[model samples]
Target: MRTSPPEPLAAALVEGRTSSLKEPLLRDGRLLWLEQRPQEQGRTTLMLRPAGGDTAVELTPSPHNLRSRVHEYGGGVYAVGGNDLVFVDDSDRCLWHLNLPGAPRRLTTPGPRAFADGLIDGPRRRWLGVMEAEGRDQLVAVPLAGGEPQRLHQPADFCGYAALSPDGRQLAWVEWQQPFMPWQRSQLWLAAVKQDGALEGARPVAGARPVAVAGSGPNATDAETDTYTDTSAISVFQPLWISPTELVVASDASGWWNLQRLDTASGAWQPLLPLEAEFAMPQWVYGMRTTAWDGQQLIAAAAREGAWQLGRVHLTPDRVGTPAAWEPLEQPFDDLAGLSAEAGTLVALASNPTSLEGLLELDLTTGSWRHSPAAPCPLQPEAISQPEPLWFAGHGGVRTHAWFYPPAGGAHAEAPLLVKGHSGPTAMARRGLSLGIQFWTSRGWSVVDVNYGGSTGFGRAYRERLDGQWGVVDVADCAAAAQALVAAGKASAARIAIEGGSAGGFTALAALCFTDVFRAGASRYGVTDPSALASESHRFEARYLDGLIGPWPEARATYEARSPLAHADQIRCPVVFFQGLDDQVVPPEQTERMAAALEANGIPVEVHRFAGEGHGFRSGSVRIQVLEATEAFFRRHFQR
Candidate 1:
């Protein structure tokens, strides 16, 4: 427990979420959480704690429009939701109701695009599922003694996770319809209630097929109608019903993304974890994929050999059975930031990159499932650092999936190297635990996290290989995976450096303005113009850069030729820039007009900004002072 390294504050390195132990209503101990605070104009809130024994009660109040999220929903009840205003809480709309342990009751009434996804507690009724604000998704129910919510199915473009069928009668959901997004395929409806539980007939189990839905909506069709078959892949995103007939999904139609088993009868889907390459790991429900089903046992959580453990699969679809043998149960922690299963116990959220890390809870009634530590930051499991996984051959040979780390060198040794570029170019840089990759691998750097190439649990045409190649194949596969890790010496091609923070800072300013493979690069709020992120971002990525770099004045010459602030004099290295002047979405005038075109071409430039931060960068001493000012700006510009 030697602690002598802690005094650099605000370059905003990392802290997207925090607040672990909650939902342990273990029949009467009561727990509840969802903290995440930092504030100081560095912005980052989301309160509500309520555990009350050793003490814990924030219950929403950091201020400036409290924003939080959690959904235990058992006896203590939960649905947190945020933003009474911190910057307009779209997804945190509200759902509180702590009840027994006490204080919390907001429950629906958010309307300006209200959102919620993740809450399923049933015995006699309790489901919140929601997603409205026009993305259209529903499931209300509520009545464990609350009343008046009812409003069940909406689905026409998207609907979320609505699972309840263990004698609760029948209601499994996971609909998806759009240009398709829910890991590219989703459809697994199965309603049928009517004995006063409401909800009837619905159907669609293995995501039938058809495709074509062109027409404008709501009586205001000025004109537009071409394609029109309208049906879909019926994909099915997470769905986990464990018995009202049988369930356990996470599809991808066998090209990969395995773990099937489904069969509420005849709709068949069998595969009990046999896609071969072993799967699961690539944002499901934005992140957090549960497998649950306790009344005997069925717990799950995939992401094989590369990590994300806690396996268990005995789910008998009835008869010829013999597949339940997946058990890994919390020993892989380098990414699986969340997990679920109740009563018999199994709460996971293991980490990796480090920061005292947390969110564990495994209890498996004591025969197995142990782990339950690290949360609310205390530090000491060896100062954290776990994300391993790595794989290669991206871009065209495909494959992908990363999280490497090697030079967090303390005495300062094998340093020099920093590749990272993960900002959901459809996200994926799993293998969790991250303190912004240990503030540059604990000073000495040596990191690589490029999950570039339309990521997401590799399937569906390798997640549509960045549909229409965004910024030329995610900036040439993040400079050919850092030139295959500097031709396999595993780093240091002249002190590498590629940093990223949003689309991996648009793949580190398009790999230093069109590939030279790093010599210096950093861009916090990235995206230096892709037609202004398809005309200003966020509405779940406003048309997401017209499907990643296209459209908009007809691609406006590929967004003024792959914006490095419009070719900042073809960047010759030495660059650093972070933004948040209340970033409305890549706007700090695109990093002050690309640091004045790389300081008018003399190169070497630095620009930081963080006033009341927006877009991303939420306090934690300003993300450990943006990871020690990005390792002292790469030791005064690569003299590392």
Candidate 2:
């Protein structure tokens, strides 16, 4: 094959970017997923690929945004039971039921209540999910025939990832109280499904005391209980039912987020795979699938060292010890998401640094894999920069990993390096070809997407490196990665710039303030003041800083000492802050304060607050605008 020539990446290419295929749902020989259309101003619609079909059908029409803003980073926007569908509308937060024969009918009333992580239970004739109402989160059951939703389980500070048993008589969900993020510590509960679909006799499988059902249990005055088990050490997630009596979960009690099974009968826990890699990720959004079970076999996505790979485990009567006994499935992609399996067919959203992302289907029996609606790379192969997996010593000799993308054609011998930190502070940098990163690398800038301390993929030992050291560890790791790149002659030390969104944005601000490694920085709604984030953040992340930094009031001094806003006088570099006015995660005022502080200090500062956008930029126009503005700002301060 003849090699194509290299070319510079254009903003139009970024504006036309379309490769994110999200929320793959497989049922009754049909596969449906979401595709974001940049040309449509970042409008997302549902696309269906029928079983054995080559083309996909756009199920959702125009002006209908099938998205949920429940937890901010929305997911579980739609659920399918055969042909019946229940989805949350982003515009009105209403649940709409679609039968595919006519227009979608509104099922739930419009109110302050937002529903997400939807699961359809055809046997019970109800839709199950996590509901947030009046500042409380709980598991709710909505009748398919359309009426007021019933609060099924007890209210907690936050609740999500409600999964139904195969028999539909039992429900399992995860809940965490204040001051502890889901990743920090959460309890897994299994509740008995009442005759009317109300949850009863709820008990913690891995945490606190058995929950009382209102007037039915030991402490009964009403129909629900508010006092929950105080399990502030063990974190659990992905409570999937492998069998009617047994539930599989990924718990971090054993250090890593490993796969384990909880017997609903004896409540005994069984360790399936005690490996170091994580089988479950931090619950940033709804409906994040890490493992899929088909009653006989299991397909799981596991992460190690920042890369994700899929594995297959056959369920047998003699199912035993370590992950060594399980079968390892070979795949072309390094990043796997949304793993769903049924009837020997497994589907996942897979991608790599060189491949465009799409819905990948695998035939377990034949080991045949295929991707639907394949997106071919518009740019020539040479124009794209493949990321080189990098690991370096960061803060206290901790091993930190990052993906380094060199500039195309090696044009700049000492290229301006852009260190990008991922959000989640708890989330890992995905191993895939992100056009946003390519946009920088193709424009003669080296990019490093850092999976610093506190990031997932690495075991709990490495992840906890940020405990009570959030601002310190993340900033050190980013600066260390940049300095290591400069030491390797890959990046110009004086021209290094740092950029991030959300928690990552906090790292960028901290790097610019506390360190001299970066000359310029861009924060996309970054946390400038930890105190503001702890007090003013949403219910989901209100107490996140407790573990990220420390608990409030008691750790008030620590938060102030670590916050970038407190030390803005030391940051002399030009910084650009891009924030959404509607961002509830890190309030827009956080970014505005940082910008004002920089400007007050006579340091160059630019702040862009976008309307109609949340924590993350979804609109194409704003994305393009932020990209262009950041590039221009970086070029202006590249230290020629």
Candidate 3:
């Protein structure tokens, strides 16, 4: 049988039309995952595939979003135990449970409290998760039989990644105080679990302590202290127990987030694999898994030099010498997530330039793999733009990385270059096939994704390059990358444009205002005023600017000097702004004010606002509308 040829890449590059699958959970011979279906009224549903079954079962019914809004970037939304699945409903922020093939039943009361980062405690018949309520965050246990939640440990500004020991005798979690985000400085805590499932005798690992904590009470005066004064601060993420007295975690104490093992009996941490690559990621959302450990081996994903790779490590009871090299897993993915290990089988979400995101299962012994909801290449091989990894000297000759995707066809001798700044000033741009980037490249444009200063995966020094230099360092690196591309004849020097959302949007605006590298700019709910963001943002990132730009009032001059709104007159090129009316992170007013400023400065400006949208657009039609508007706007100015 012969298959029909694929349609044009541009025609298939509809924004938000493709489903994004995440968080693969394997247990009891079943595969469970989360599927965010934008076409289904932007509903994010849970799915399950029984053992040896080829069809996927839609476990989440209508109007029920298996999502949690905790920390505003929800993750750890669902957990599985035997034939039951526990999840957080986005509508009311309550825990819900569903026996296999049955309708979901509400398990917790609906209220102001938000629950996320859930872990299934089968031994205790409870759900261990991070709960935010009444102005404090705590790790708590909610009984599966439906009862009042019991607070497990001391409260912190934020808590996440609650993992229970296999024997249910202990609990491990990650906590961090305010003024510092999880990526900045966080501590790992181990505590004894009582018969009643309450946590006690809590102690910090590696001699680390909370930076600041005013006791637990309504009368506490300084509950909002947002500074990490500890000199030897370390950030830990994703603690998983490999044995009753042993656990594996990723820590950045050595300047990179490498794997480390903590022995409860000895209270000493053993470095497993020490390298510059990151085995963990920033806990921006709950339920993010980077490393998976079976009883004897581990499957982990690490990022190095803007690319993601998979590898495995064998474990022993005693401390062993580090292997000369990691046992590399040959996979076709450049991006991986939701890693899980069951009976030596590794299941994860994998994707790359030629494939859509899907669930991947690999049998370590036989070197066999299977991809579900199989996504064959939607375009001809020649139509897909392969990314070329490039490094250029940033400001002060500091090294920086980016992935350049030239126009797929050789039809266009000179093409407009799109300088894309990814969000998470602390986040790295993983090399993968992004439909948004491909949309531009397939339409005769060259796209370069800049992993500017402060992006993760690199060593601590590289990740902290933007500390107190957010706008300055990021803007300079992005501009430098674009200039380098033009110099190398990979892009048209006269037709370069910059675009980004959130922090990335702020970089786009700064690149256009502070440098002459980009001819036009598009910002999606980008930060316009650092001072305003410091005040109006949510609690999760309210004090984040203290490190990015510095504490307010002391660095007020620098904030004013670097803000895009303050230097609007310097923007001599056309600019477009896309904003979500309901965004709490970078408020819509920031985009509105910047658009007004651009118009006042005699620069052509376009502003499009979508209602019922938040920090990011979940509606497929809205995303497509924005993409169309942005394309038309960029071409009009570039062709002029």
What TM-score does each of the candidates earn?
Answer: 0.33, 0.94, 0.94
lDDT of 2 by residue, 508-549 (tens): 988888899998999888889988888787777877787778
lDDT of each: 0.58, 0.81, 0.81
Instruction: Give the Cα-based TM-score of candidate 1 against the true structure.
Output: 0.33
Task: Count backbone overlaps in model 3.
Answer: 5
lDDT of 1 by residue, 1-640 (tens): 2234333222343453343332222222233344334534322233332333544555444442333221111111234222111112323554544443354455555544444554545434454455454434355555534544566554455556566676767777765554445555566767775566666665555664453322222221214233223354525556677668777777767666777776776666567766443355443233345566666787766654445456667655443455545655535454554455556665555654443445555667664533444344433445444555566786776667676676532322235778888776776666655555665555545687877777665555665788867777777777777677677766777788888887778778887888776888878877777776777654445555655666677768877887777788888888878787876766788778778878988998888888867666666655556666767887888775
Cα shift from native, residue 632, model 3 (Å) = 0.7
Pairs with backbone N, CA or C atoms under 3 Å apart (clashes), candidate 2: 214-220
**What lDDT would candidate 1 get against the real structure?**
0.58
Worst 10 residues of 3 by lDDT: 1-10
Worst 10 residues of 2 by lDDT: 212-221
Steric clashes per prediction: 34, 1, 5
Tens digits of per-residue lDDT for model 3, 1-640: 2123223354235554677787888887788888887777568898888888877888987889877888788778898887767899988889998878788989899888898888788878887787888877877778888876676654557778878888888888887877888887888878788786665566566425536543322223454332233536778889998888888898888899888888887776678878888898878887788899766788889888777889987665555544324788987787888899898789988878766677888998888997764345456666677788889999778989988887756423367899999998787787666777778877778888988999888878888898889999999999999888888877888899999999999999988889998899999889998889987788899889999998987889989989999999999999999999999888888888889988987999999999999998887778888888898899898873
The better candidate by TM-score, 1 or 2, is 2
RMSD of each: 22.7, 2.9, 3.6
Give the Cα RMSD of candidate 1. Answer: 22.7
Range of the 10 consecutive residues with the lowest summed lDDT in candidate 1: 68-77
